[model samples]
Target: MEADTYTQSAFEAELPIPRGMARIMRFSNDQPTNHVFRRGAHYWLDLCLTPRPEKARGCYSERWGPHRFERLGEIFLVPPGEALHVRTDAGDNQASIACEIHADSVDHWLETPLEWTDRRLEGGLDIVHPYIRSCLSRLAEEMRHGGTGSAELAAMIAGQLAIELARYLEAISESPITGGLASWRLRLIDERLHRGGSTPSLGELAELCSVSIRQLTRGFRSSRGFTIGDHIAQTRIEMAKRALASDDSIKSIAFALGFASPSSFSYAFGRATGVTPLRFRQRHLRGRE
Candidate 1:
């Protein structure tokens, strides 16, 4: 695993990432990515392999914390200004997921058939694993060959990578969120629809907020008139409405939302809207009921 970057130069785009969209990044031993530090303004996430540097390292939010973080395999929800830093060497190495998604993106996904958002998961290095290696290998191969639709293809590959990571996190950790969820939960689950958007199956989310699942979800029905998960779904439907008004493929939309496949996305979309995502988009865009 020598250091190299498929996105060798700064890769920037103004492309429309329909709601629920996601991406995956892999850093091997060969490629040493400088690993961008994220500003909430910049992107939703920045997964990296590079670890704390021996020398001084500053990032978008604040200076790298004075801690030694080796053996990198984690997904963390960085607070507004906090950043995880990494510097490479023999035992201490560079590897990570530079995933930057937006809240708008998460909302769009809810409209489709995805189960939950990263907000639903516990953020930690334990999230990344080798199960994704095969997929990443295929993506890298595709990147090496330039052709028509390469960028779009690259985007697709990246999206799947994020989906897989999300799945992995959902499967392994039983850790609940802790602390200060009053504000964090409100902000994180803002796509409110059914209830107050406060119930707790997103075990990872519980970990992120540092609160017990019981406190987060107890008697939520009496307060919100729906289950916490239902509230999350309704909020997702609201997000789907916006995507319906935009111009994007239903397939892309479903993928962004983390459907196991497009068929699932379509099925879920139809269930929610009484029409397919495309039909909903068309009907909504044309101002038809």
Candidate 2:
């Protein structure tokens, strides 16, 4: 599909990665826009950069084959040779990153011929995968800031994306969806938390699970027998322990783990483990010695 077909959104940037192309788009229209693609020759994955406002009227309703869904603040994947129709309502100005991967790259990653009948291959909308999200987010960031190592990083990310996409397809195909957060959803939460960077907020985690904040909290509690906040606190402490083992300073680790300040991290760590971070590290080093 030509970029100009949808006047509501404009292509802000496009970059070439290994076996694919990535583009950033910005939507600034006041009216709803319609997009139709007739059996594209490549796999398309789009990640929303700007989330939809809670009270916004804008949303994306997509039709792929016989399946139809309405979603926002989630990644949309369209497999090769699938007719896709999308209607996007205008709301807050939004930006998205789209990556188009060639069919050969996908097949190569899978090491087998593509199966069109596989439900996993019939990608629709609101696909939730944390690893894919991390890769695409990194890709978008690299494209946004073209630097000396951008090309190498983009190529590496594309390769990782291809592998993750294949694995995700296989996993979803074999796994059945159930009530309350599934095993995969829990894994998503774990992966996102274990990912070393700023911790994700509750809303961000909800969006990652393709559910509302309330739903995520209730479902997680029901399934895990503990609150999501509890899980996050525990995970943060574990991460802090690992970082403390390293030579990095506690203040840096605190900021990296989304703590407000060194004092706050110390308080939380002490509450969780009955000792301050420095004390824990001292004990750990002493044991090693």
Candidate 3:
């Protein structure tokens, strides 16, 4: 429950935060700030107030991929005891309202052990979830204009946020197709695909993992609910997303990813993401702006 407001100067004000309760704080600054906790005891949700071309980077257990604040709202959930560092270089002020939900509150809602699990909204952070957005806006308004019922209202909203987060975590935790591939094997395959290497056939994958084709297929299907071919297709699609986010041409991306033709690539991409390659790139480019 500690924060550091670092700046080039020395002017800071203590926020009137209710101890051990959920609260929101407005953050808008050009400079970056790293907030460290000796031991984190809260689940934090940050809603971006201004969309930035360069998404902010945070380091918890690992350095996550670069993420843009989609127009719907970009949210991040921080787990207990994990230090948080926020780097904002959007060329303008990065404005966002963050809500802190204490661990005890989340524990009351969730029965699972979540001591080190941090999560963010998946699928490019373009979440148009009405409830999450509305709760953030209301909490910000209440914090801005405090009154007798403001505290109660803020607490209720924070509780709802915690509930939503717990539900999402629990749902995702119940994934049926996890822990299928070995970490090393998955990483090796991911590297080869992401580096624009040729797609490996079933035989090649079997040799790569030192397993027979039949064994590989059986284990992978049982673990991931998808065959090796499907895994490769999905990996290539993810690589296509990264390439499309950059200035790479669709044709070049298709060729580099080993797609037989641009049309084939389009079909596969649409099937994987429900959108065409051009559409995915266009959406990302718009988000950058």
Candidate 4:
């Protein structure tokens, strides 16, 4: 665990004026002084964060949840038109670098509108979510070295980040079809498929939801985008992908996912995914670029 504590210098003239489309700035053992701010048009962000070096203390900002608090390692996405108060810090240890970006850099990929508000990653950052952290680090490097020619790089990085965020949201949505709120059936279905393929039959699914097949199907249609069978197929393929990564036998994999016969599983996997199971595994593993 780390504590935040730092006294910042008095307000400097407002932040980067005539905001550059891409800007690189680093903060070390520093705090941002109080000021009112709102997201203007066009913005993306990559912040390098770490535990505060000094004591944990204060911040009075809507950019953060209100509190005289410790600075945690998280990033804020200030979208256009969102208002925020950048507050004074009461922490003694804090260090971060922010690469502020404009929306023109990522408009096409905005999936869930995780825009210009304070979005906090719970607990500590998952440096191992390589798809995400790698892009953030890459964006930082581009901001650092690309200099004035960083716009193109920023746009590229924004696209990658947006996709990762979409995937995360997708995962969240798909995790509660059987055991969540009534509105979350689709999400649960999607999450199960993503997790390890569906081992549940219609009877099993209905039992899990404590409903009859007819009623569940009606409700699921209103919520889940795909039928139970289709979703199961999707989940099975995803699981097969992971299985393929290992040296497991195809027959064994088929049995593991509840296929009655290896041939049936391979045929279904190939027909739906356009590649036989073994081929899919080899291609993905051999071509992991």
lDDT against true structure, model 1: 0.41
Order candidates by lDDT, high to low: 2, 3, 4, 1
- Count of backbone collisions within predicted model 2: 0
Which run of 10 residues does model 2 get worst, by summed lDDT? 52-61
Please give, for residues 143-194, the per-residue lDDT of candidate 1 as tens digits.
Answer: 3344788667757765665565455434432333342246445545543232
Better of 2 and 3 by lDDT: 2
Q: Which candidate, 1 or 4, has the higher lDDT?
A: 4
- Candidate 1's clash total is 43
**How do the residues 1-289 of candidate 3 rate in per-residue lDDT, one tens digit apiece?**
3456333222111122333433333344445544432237766666643343243555542334334222222555556665554555524333456666667776777776653422232311323333565666566556546678766666677767667766655544334444456757755665665577578888887788887888778766644333567557655765676677767789998999898899999998776555588876775554444
Candidate 1 segments exceeding 4 Å error: 1-184, 191-201, 219-223
CA lDDT of each prediction against the hidden true structure: 0.41, 0.68, 0.56, 0.47
Off by over 4 Å in 3: 1-28, 31-39, 61-73, 115-129, 145-148, 174-289
**Residue 202, model 4: Cα distance from true site in angstroms:** 1.2
For this target, which candidate reaches the highest lDDT against the unseen true structure? 2
Candidate 2, superposed: residue stretches over 4 Å from native: 2-5, 53-67, 70-73, 121-124, 174-289
> In order, how many clashes per candidate?
43, 0, 0, 26
Give the Å shift of residue 140 in candidate 3.
1.2
What does candidate 2's lDDT look like per residue over 197-244, in tens digits?
777889999999898999899877655434688768766775686677
Clashing pairs in 2: none
